[model samples]
Target: MNVVKRQIDLKRMFTCTTFADRVRFLIELAVTAPSTHNSQPWRFVITQESCRLWFEPKKQLKEADPSSRDLFISLGCVLENFVVAAQYYGMYKEVRLHMKENFVAEVFLYDRAAAHQEEYRSLCESILKRYNARGLFERTNIHEATLKRIEDIAQKYTEQGVRLQVVQNSTDIKNVAELTAKGIRIARSKPLFRKEFAQWFRTNLSKKQDGIPGYAVGLPLLPSFIAPFLMRYCSLAKVLVRKNTESILTAPAVCVIESDTDSPETWLQVGRLAERVMLECYAHDLATSIYVAAIEMDNMSQELAQTLELRGRPQFLFTCGVPLTNHRKFTPRLSVDLVLK
Candidate 1:
């Protein structure tokens, strides 16, 4: 029902009979971009000439992301969607990135819609179809051609310091899984961390527009409500460590996206590269689930870089393979009116 409402609202907003402004149309796609814990920490100020994207810093998961790296990364995903939607719609956007508090970027729009829709149609379609696959991925390995295609997409980023490293062999996967397990154990043991993380789990559909829903993660409605309490009081070190380790170990492959420097701008670039690859995954008929433990914990993220000899800061790691299911409901998004500044 929530998904239907969102899709209906989008149809109404973008119909040709409506105003059909590029900024508004692009925003409809922008909000679909994923964020850590589904925080959706973004607001937009739409003017006649431009749409300014501001970061909502309070939405930052301080416990899970103390450096706020993931916050800007999430904003980057929004920005990436904005850019893609703009190009797809035949509009040229001028973006200015400002890595400060609640002030990310201002995107000036050009009225001319895409002259050649055919050129952008592939990724354009991917925008609507792309989703994060969180369930167990199929045991099959991804085809080499698809992997290279996605790598090509990441390579196209060409921005300074950002690079994508793909891990496929069993040995490397095992090493990463072990490090991630350690991080999970340490992260779950901290009361403050679990407490902060718990606030984002929404069991009731009507309750919140953002946050990871219980059903989305395969948890029943009632038990999910108690997750916060358990995270704070109970020791989840064993369960999380076990589950996270097994998932990584059994997955066919993992992707590590990293940057040479650990700065807001670099992380933002990481977001763009990450989204491009994620969208490309959909284009290749594959699935991706972000595994942040290797990058969320400072020590583990550092160790991961060393393990891969990346010579950079690791920002994200995730499983990639054939999806077990494709019937994923779109996560809810706050209304456009609510996010407008």
Candidate 2:
């Protein structure tokens, strides 16, 4: 399951007494966007006219995402949120994506952000409310009408080569579930990979602002605490492998988001598209849980690409289903002060 990053007391930020305050407000919203393992792998520098967004190299999930796919994708999600928030706040955003050292994307916010009006109102509203719903989802099939609407929302802004495919056929779903299980086995077999993966699981909310807290990922508080200690055992992961496959099959539908190539730009597109799909799902009262580790496995990913008939590289896999519960808790983020330069 996913949760909103804890919000900063923006009473201080909303004053807009200065242009910096205005920029800060939008950055606050942008960081609320999701990241792999709640890594929060980004930083920003704000000027009166624009916001320079950068990826934190130290924040990269090197072990889990050596190719840095999840890293850039997470940044892309943040950029989308920043754009939407800027639009709603009345600032025209000219975003330029490039690579310079640790930089990912930069936005020049013009005062003339045209009125978004009703176009993205619902999607923006779903921003804070959207969490990774990772638990059991109802087995009821998603309506055909809902599928069409979701397809309509999945459209991309550029020809930079990104695509979203939904899987519903029982055979296709089984293929995805089995592939995900195989990916898990491949990763869990390694002792170092398991060790690095366990470090990201924050046992309690009070422990750290970033990283996946146990409960937010569906581990109850007690298991959350014990997870770290038991995470070293390969046997523990084996026991839970069945749970992953079974849960994935329960989704009403699974979304496979891919890009034409594996580059910062394409991964960024994947991130933006993934968030768009998630927000659309949220508007329809569907919950989403992103599965990245399995997608990171090359063999499993190739099988997924062939199974889904995706012309491009598959970067993300997530499920959408009716939620069994209304999860109010949110995964936390580092405070704005820490994220801002």
Best by lDDT: 2
Query: What would the TM-score be for candidate 2 when compared with the true structure?
Result: 0.91
| Candidate 1 lDDT tens digits, 138-255 | 7788888988888888887756578888998899999998888878878887888888877786775547888877677666768777776776788778877776777677778888
lDDT of 1 at 169: 84
Q: All candidates' lDDT scores?
A: 0.76, 0.78
Candidate 1 positional error at 178, Å: 1.3
Query: All candidates' TM-scores?
Result: 0.91, 0.91
Over 203-240, each residue of candidate 2 has an lDDT whose tens digit, in order, gives 86455888778777678777888887677665465666
Q: Hey, what RMSD does candidate 1 come out at?
A: 3.0
Model 1 TM-score (2 dp): 0.91
Model 1 bad stretches (over 4 Å): 1-21, 112-116, 204-206
